[model samples]
Target: MATINPVKFIQQVRAEVSKVVWPTRREVLLTTVMVFIMAALAAAFFAVVDLLIRTGLSGIYGIFG
Candidate 1:
């Protein structure tokens, strides 16, 4: 079994955290807006596809019933 020293682990964690390049506020906001736009577009596309499928199924039932 490998043993981990708590003090050494904490020092390594802090070092790694300091090396991280955090995203700027502008970049975060732009990406958030893009995600919302993509989500809305995806929802709209799925709604249209559902409507088309429903219409097709209804037509099929009407023809057979």
Candidate 2:
């Protein structure tokens, strides 16, 4: 592989960084809030599923034991 010069590499990195479309503060906040909401919903869903499974297993074991 060919080695890139340090100065050229730094210039290329800066050029790429400048081309990025960074999110605005409002957009960032909205996305963060959405993420939190989705995470909470997922946690609740898993908790309910876990409770159902545990109850089902307990009932089965109770009948057999």
Candidate 3:
């Protein structure tokens, strides 16, 4: 295996970092909004399913109580 020189290694790392494509502020805002919207929809869906299951189990338990 080849060993890296400290200064050259740092330069290479900086070069690679400079090549990265970063999102703009507007793009980040749009993506964040979409994520929240999807999360809210998923939460609503699970809440309905959970309510149905709880109601069903309560009825089953009441039969023996």
For every candidate structure, what is the RMSD over all alpha carbons to the true structure, in angstroms?
Answer: 1.0, 1.4, 1.5
In model 1, which runs have C-alpha deviations exceeding 4 angstroms?
none
What is the C-alpha lDDT profile of model 2 across 1-65, one tens digit per residue? 99879999999999999999999999999999999999999999999999999999999999998
Worst 10-residue lDDT window, candidate 1: 56-65
Candidate 3 residue 41 Cα shift, in angstroms, is 1.3
lDDT-based ranking, best first?
A: 1, 2, 3
Candidate 3's TM-score: 0.82
Model 3 lDDT at residue 44: 100
Candidate 3 stretches with Cα past 4 Å from truth are: none
Computed on alpha carbons, the lDDT of every model, listed in order, comes to 0.99, 0.99, 0.98
TM-score of 2: 0.87
TM-scores, one per candidate: 0.91, 0.87, 0.82
